[model samples]
Target: MFTGIVEELGTVEAVEPLADGGRLTISGPVVTADARHGDSIAVNGVCLTVVEVGEGRFTVDVVSETLRRSSLKGVAPGEKVNLERAMALGDRLGGHIVQGHVDGTAVLRATEPDGLTRFEIPERLSRYLVEKGSITVDGVSLTVVEAGDREFSVALIPTTKQLTTLGVRQPGDEVNIEVDVLAKHLERLARPQLDGLARGE
Candidate 1:
């Protein structure tokens, strides 16, 4: 699990193809300071297990399922990525509970800028969003400032823009999206009741 708070902006050092998966060597000095083999780290909201650790880099194996669900499939060396260590017990929930399990990917439809500020929302994942609801985009926690049937917007402060990948996002870019877990649970719980009402039962 994670808090959706980005700890560092790491880079992909290398990528090697494996038979059923692939090995990624990512450079993250802070997250690997005390890291060891078999530790889990959240990369761009995707939980990855550490296979080896060096000076400031670590290796992780990406299975086919993860590749299909995230934007990591075509990731190349030198690409910047968000990094966060798994949430420890008793830690303050700075952001919402992020599973690092991406629900899907969204396409950047547009960016509205003001004062070097911007709001970048996905056209595909807008339905799950609501005003003031929590969202994880590229592993950074943000709130929806506005929403629509096919698009939602988030106001990005300068710090967030500089520290994470959202600062560089452009129209037509793909981003990993993890919807609020609580909202999903509530929807599941209400589904049957709503169905019964529709049936006049």
Candidate 2:
């Protein structure tokens, strides 16, 4: 698991195609300082395993499923990506609990000079979002300012605008989004009751 707090802005060094998936070589000095194979790292909110570590860089294999679910499908060399090491036990949860599991991708709809940004999300994911709820976007945890049927907005601070990939993201860009895990759990736990109510029982 992760805290959605970005530790570094890493660069994609290379991408090698594989039969069933692909391999990515990313240069993230901080995350790889003590990294070893099988470690979990959140790269742009996707929990990818370390395949190998070498000289301030590491390799990860992205399967077809991850590519289909995230914005990493067509990631290229030299692109910047948010990087975070997996949180250790008893560590402070600076941000919300992020599983690094991208529920889906959201599109950057618009942006304002003051960091009030809007994103158009998949309609099905809207139910989990609420005002003030936590959402992970491209590995950065942010609070939802407004929620809509197909869109939502968040207020980004100056530090966020200069530290993560969201800072340089332009309109029309697609980014990974993870709705709060707690919300999903609650919904699952209440589904049976909700179904009974729907039947007027």
Candidate 3:
């Protein structure tokens, strides 16, 4: 698991298309310092395993499923991506629990000068959002300030803007999103109880 704390902003060095998927070569000096084969790295919020590691660069294979669920499908060379290594057992949970599993993608709908950003999410994912809830956008964890039917807003501090890819995002740009996993677990656990209540059991 990851904490959604971006360790570095990496650049996509190359992309190679395959019959079933694609291979990505990314350059992240910090994250690749101790990298090895089979190590997992969160690339723009999608967890990808390292297939090979070289000087300040690592390669990973992106399967078709991951592409369908993330904005990585449209990624190309020269793109900046958020990078984070899996959290160590005793490391501080600086942000929140980020599984690095992109649930879906959200489109940046608006942005304000005062650090407020709004994103248009799918209706199905909206239920998982709450005021002050945690959400990972492009691998950076943020809290929701406003939750709507198909949109949510988050306030970004200057530090966040300067350290991550979010600072350069524009309206209509698609970002990978992962809602709070706790919310999903709670919802699943409550379903059976709700069903019993509905039947007057």
- By TM-score, the best candidate is 2
Candidate 2 local distance difference test against the native = 0.95
Q: State which candidate, 1 or 2, has the greater lDDT.
A: 2
TM-score, one value per model: 0.92, 0.98, 0.97
Alpha carbon lDDT of residue 179, candidate 2? 97
Candidate 3 achieves a global lDDT of 0.95
Residue-wise lDDT of candidate 3 within 1-201, one digit each (tens)? 999999999999999998888999999999999999999999999999999999999999999999999999999999999999999999999999999989999999898777689999999999999999899999999999999999999998888888999999999999999999999999999999999999999
**What are the runs in model 1 whose C-alpha is more than 4 Å off?**
115-125
* Candidate 2 ranges beyond 4 A from true positions: none
Number of backbone collisions per candidate, in order? 0, 0, 0
Residue-level lDDT tens digits of model 2 in 104-161: 9999989967768999999899889999999999999999999999999999998887
lDDT values of the candidates? 0.86, 0.95, 0.95
lDDT of 1 at 121: 44
For residues 92-194, write the lDDT of model 1, one tens digit per residue.
9999989988987877766665432233445555657898898888898888877677666778888888999888888778888898888788888999998
Better candidate by TM-score, 1 or 3: 3
